[model samples]
Target chain A: MQKLTFPRMGESWRTFKMLLEDLGNEVVVPPRPSKRTLDLGVRYSPEFACFPLKILTGTYLEAIEMGADTIVTSGGIGPCRAGEYAMLHHKILADLGHNIKMVVFEPPRFYPFNFIKNVYILNRARHSIRGIIALIKKAWRKLQALDNAEKLSHVIRPRELITGTTTRVYRKGLEWIDQAYTNEQIIDAETAALEALRNVPQNPEAEVLRVGIVGEIYVLLEPASNLEIEETLGNLGVEVERSMFLTGWTRDNTWTETTEGMTVKAAAEPYLPELVGGHGRDSIGNTILCAKRGFDGMIQLAPFTCIPEIVARTILPKVSRDYDIPVLTFFLDEQTGKAGMTTRLEAFVDLMRRKKHFRQGNGLLTG
Target chain B: MKAYLGIDVGSVSINIVVLNEAGEVITGLYLRTKGRPIEVIQEGLKQTAESIPPDVKIAGVGSTGSGRYLAGIMVGADVIKNEITAHAVAASMVIPDVQTVFEIGGQDSKIIIMRHGIVTDFAMNTVCAAGTGSFLDQQASRLNIPISQFGELALKSTSQVRIAGRCTVFAESDMIHKQQMGHQIPDIINGLCEALVRNYLNNVGKGKEILPPIAFQGGVAANVGIKAAFEKALGFPIIIPKYFNVMGAIGAAQIACEEVSRKGETSFKGFQITNLPYRTGSFECDGCSNVCEVVEIFEGEKVIGRWGSRCSKWDITGENK
Candidate 1:
């Protein structure tokens, strides 16, 4: 069996690990990307490559260094830069003298044969179709559990009386979920962890603000790259709701499952008119939904020079005016300073708080 | 007899202002920063102390501009704000119904859109000198005229001369080429002014609605040529407040006053800090791949403040963690 590895994008890492491990392949998990990881990516990556691409390359290099002989990553199609990442990554790694097997899963319609062949290779340990089906079911259950626990953390963190308590509990919950081998254990751990989170002292009467965070998936999910915006917002007594979840996105993309029925494309139809590549449409749709749901404000986080996000940014002001909601957009780069970020956040929160107060005074609060 | 002190330390200039409880400017001073923020601030403070009445107490202190953090720590400011907020606040204070503000500083420029006295939208120039005062200063020197007289020269233009003001390099070359063409100096100067206003509206003010009751203030507000150019371009005269050049400092003072009222106390270090043996030093921390340059400020042998690290491992204050 080949040693397989994948970059830690979000909760997707655990799902991939379970899937590959169940298939009898030795899965090597790269440590979470850090400053060192970013440095490795910066050192070898093309100067003009997007921030997420550089980080992904860095993770691959780290995984290879950790003795992983095979790389499995998703591939995009069309105008999005993501489509070229896998091929460029393979070439770059080879140039750096690391010869590793690379498997990129493109959309089934685009490369069905290659996708099936890759699956067959991964299923070397348990070749039976029934075994593969059962294995996938278990992994899917784990993904749900992981997503639920993460969602709970986002809600609880802002209302917690003690600073960092919810975060600590969430970290422990993640570890518990990671260690669970069976579907039953995963469900058990998820329930017990959420219960533990409930026990954390929380201020029931605390006047908290709800902020919806929407933007590029990688930047939104990766805490280090975004300077831990969710944690910072939570600290400032704001409840954060992410517009994207890894499990939901992956499931929807793979199985065409429409849980909400209200797709981002549909929501953004009036404003965006057409889908531009990347998360631009999603950002607009999510922000509009957040406003309709009575969120006090919205924050858009995207990498500097991200074209799709820039388009979304230009249109956000009109949305803000229409919805009577405030939106703050931050363009992150290597030179982004924490001080500047904090100042902007502080000002934005202040604006939202005042707006909420003014609206409440005008008797607009739903009784 | 209580007043708030506001300090605006920017790349090219440092402005210090004193404001009383009525939000009236008591005294204001503008000085060139010249790459020495600490020294310039101290000098400004010394001059402020000497100018102001002895009985007036400093109730609060605020710092704004790019070096806001450093100035905030140095002065023990009660409020530290960004230039956008400061500019908006000052503009709104001067003209209560101000809907738009165009602030062009020494090396930076910004546009603020206001609604009912609240800053609703804003944009700042991203590392571009084309729409800022520095470019005008450079051109003034290159044309063998003092910066103070540059605006007057611009006002004397007889014919329209177009100067490309996309980038600083191209603008300089374009200016020289126009000069070789024998267009009068004033025409070139006026053209440069119009070009700058055009660049500002195209870039910083891009996609932003430019509503009426606009107030233009900054270090660059003193340039009547730019003001006239803006008036011509927007087809409306802009309100340049009496304390135009020192608006950022005034805004900082206003925010500081509000902060003091809310907190019921002040963190102001007092003007006597001018006499203190204060110094700043920085060292690169190799503990992580980030290579954060940790800057530390000292009051004699005692380390006062530290910042610039992504992680606060080297922060001596113990507050960051």
Candidate 2:
């Protein structure tokens, strides 16, 4: 059996574990992403590269050093920088004198020869369908459980608490879920984990304003991208409801719904009707959905040079006006500072509270 | 009367433009996305609903930008097009012979080359930050100045200082060094703007066939210093359209109009999209060597949309299986 190693993105650990378990091979867990990983990435990568590219470069390098023979990565063909990340990373790694074979899953367009090569890889792996299905089911169950647990924790945790424990439990639950085979086992593990986590006791009367976060997956999920915006928001007594979670994004990307009704019910409205080539649809749809859910405000966070989120920013004002909600946009890069962001968030929240108070005073609270 | 709704969801903001059937912008809303695109769209829609006349019929909807897929789903957009196409359409509507377009938004910057009223080639900066609105905003904040005042400050400069503007880090350090060396604030600011223009030209505008009749749009076009610097560098007066900030939305709306006019119908999901229960989830795909982290959206029991599939195996057919 060929030793397969995968680069770590958010929540990728769980998926890799499950895949290795199914393949009857020992999974070599790469080290958690850290500044060292970033440093190594920067050292080996070309300057002016995007954050994801730098991180992936580091991950691949680390995995190769750990004796992993094959590395897998995804590719895209779009206006977004991600479309070129795979090729660039390949060149960087090759130039760095690493000979580990890379398997890049090609996007819909661009580089026709690469696309054909990817098709061959998929066809060769056709025999692994059962394992894939089982792995996906297990991964889905774990993710759903983790999401539910985290959501509950947000409602119950102390106002000052970062809910890092919830994230920790979620990670553990995912680990257990990956190891579990049967549905019953997965459920059993989830229930036990949920019960144990609930028993830990949290401040029941915590009052935190909910803030919905929507934007590119990297900026939303990666802590460094948005200067740990979720943590910052949480610290400011704002419960963060990020629109893009690893589980949902993966399911939507992989699962095909048979019924139109199912599709309508399960899929986000903005991304529906068609896959329109970028995160623009998801960002806009998620923004509207978040507003309707009574979030106090919306925050659209993106990288310094993200194209899609800029488009979302252009139209968010109408959404804010229609929903009577406030939306703040934050564009982050390596140069962004903590103080500036905090000030902006503080001003936004203060305005929101003032508006709420004014409405209550006017007896306009009733819809 | 038929109305059209156009939404542009960019990296830094979400803009909405409502147009009458006659193709004139009736009302436009510009708001920052602030990390919640879903809420932004909903809020934008609600505002449009309240501001526009109740009797005005929304006959078509269009979405563009990085978030167009999401925006289309949110507004049930009748047409979804790329930013270049949408921008081109809108630019053409405003300036028929728009030979070049220099768009600097909050996050990214793009240079569109057009010949004979058609896009010939284009280049975009998705990696650098020197010429973006956010960069200027950061520099302004660092200087303890309002972003709105940045342009005026640059204009006030009597002397030009050269600051490294190829990247954000180097630019900041260079500015700090110049400031410590007793350089006036205006000079430093103007130098920064000049550096940004130089960086943009070297990066995004490199090797492109730049021509006259160029129109500058997007949020960054609001900066007079950058605009002036562009003119100085290009040796041509760059036209700043009245609706520069919302040009993407206008373009999206124009595309929507074309789609609706051509089809004679619309696929807009109507206002009910505001009421739908939507959820998102993501999981890593270890099916093959490629571990694709797929994002899925659910309304309830049904799966409506999916993305983050690098191979297009999951997205091309819209079928999970």
Candidate 3:
């Protein structure tokens, strides 16, 4: 059997890796995509392709170089260009003369059945349905643990009295979770990490600006692609809450009957009225929810030339006007510079601070 | 006498202004940067020093613009700010009730919305140079007229000839076609102004409530043609300040004054910065796979300023500092 590999989008990689391993398949987890990976993708991709597709292509190229003969990646089924990514990537790799097998887990079409079949074929010899189900359950639990650790770090990092203490502990927590081999070990690591985080000194009364980040999932989870925006905001004393999480998204979209995605769709109805494609509806709904929850401001980070995001960008102004919460949208690509982004962020922070002061002086609620 | 100094080092021009405690501009200098930002800044400082009174003490110094960090390090600035904040401050000082600010500089343009002297919203042009000063400069040279006279020529037009203003390349090609169609030069120029103003309104001013009492500043405000076009399009009179071209410098100086009043001390390095032997260079740091290009500014062979690195390993001064 050929080795399988996938791009590292979030902590879901660990869960995916465990599931494939339990099925008795040799899986090669490619290293985290860096600038070198991006350059390789850019050199071979169509000039105007969305940034995420380029990163995925780069991941596959690297994995193939590391003896990964079969590539596994998520495929989109929608009006957006995401639906075309898998076929395009296949053509790009074949054109580059690297013949390989690919199994794209496209949702709502070849979902679950194809997934199960692929796993069964990979297992061949030790195919126990009960063990596979248990393995999947354990992976799900680990994903939840990983998500909780990340949420705690996001909450504690901004208000830490000693600069970088929360960040250090958060890194250790992630490392602990990543190294744990069993469900019990994962639970223990999270508890110890959370306890260490609690020990980090934080000013309870510090007035921290709360920012909600809503955008494409690839840019949201991958710090390298988005220029470590969450870290940068934390350093600037802003408590950032991400609008998307892998475990929640997977549960909502598959297997479970979850109303979270439906609720967001309803909230976005007045503005968007239709799910244009990708996360366009989610971006609008999340920004509205964040504002309703009293967040100071919202940031939308999308790849340059992205279609669905461009739709959201066009409609976000209406959201900003109605909610009275400033929304800053950044179109990121390889051409984006840190200096310009930093300057815009600083100015946006200044604007939010002054708005808060103005409301306070007028005897109104700062939120 | 105590004064505050503001240095604005932009891609197209460099400006320095000194303001007294009363917020009056004591002396100002504007020079073309022409790619040599460091040399131009030094010349601007030396020239500004010669114009100001010898007894005037530099109480505070602030730097702004695209090249602000480098300028701040060279001048020991008390406050380093972005162009939006600096421009908003400058506009508010000029017209206390300014609701909208239309700033069109050489390479970039921005629209800042304000309410009661505080900035409420702002947007800047990205990846497009259609409505900036450089676009107008190119059109002026193409039409074989001095940029200073372009505005006057537009005012003399009796009819309108539309030129595509969505992109620079399209605008130039459209201008040539209009010329071939026998449109009068003044009419074509006036149409160009109207097109650029339309582009700015459609791109930068989209979805913003631009109220009355608007102040138009930046180097591009020197052109009366664009100002008139804006006035006609928005159905409001555009107020051009006396120091419209040097407002960024003025705003930086105002911020420095505010900083000094709050802190009761100054970080101004003084006029001697002009004589300091400084050198700037950049090299790619191969620490990780990122390979970030880190720029270093040296003052007499000591690394005083470093930037452009994604990480702070070479910044010397910690990232938070």
TM-score per candidate: 0.89, 0.51, 0.94
Q: How does candidate 2 fare on TM-score? A: 0.51
Q: List, residue by residue over B168-252, the lDDT tens digit for candidate 3.
A: 9998899999999999999999999999999999998988899989999999999999999999999999999999988999999
RMSD of 2: 19.2
In Å, residue B266's CA in model 3 sits off its true spot by 1.5
Q: Candidates' lDDT values, in order?
A: 0.83, 0.70, 0.85
lDDT per residue as tens, model 2, A1-88: 4455666655556655555555455455665555566678878876666666776777777777777666666766656778777678
- Docking quality (DockQ) for each candidate: 0.21, 0.02, 0.42
Report the poorest 10 consecutive residues by lDDT, candidate 1 chain B: B312-321
Ranking by TM-score: 3, 1, 2
The candidate scoring highest on TM-score is 3
Give the per-residue lDDT of model 2 (tens digit) for B56-105: 88888888877777788656687766676677667877888888999889
Candidate scoring better on DockQ of 1 and 2? 1
B1-321: candidate 1 lDDT, tens digit per residue: 999999999889999999999999999999999999999999999999999998999999988888887888888988877777777778878898899999998887888887777767776775467868887888888888999988888999999999898898988898899999888999999999999999999988887889989999987888989999999999987999999998999988998888788779988888888989888889989875567789999888888888776553565432211
Q: Lowest-scoring 10 consecutive residues by lDDT in candidate 2 chain B?
A: B312-321
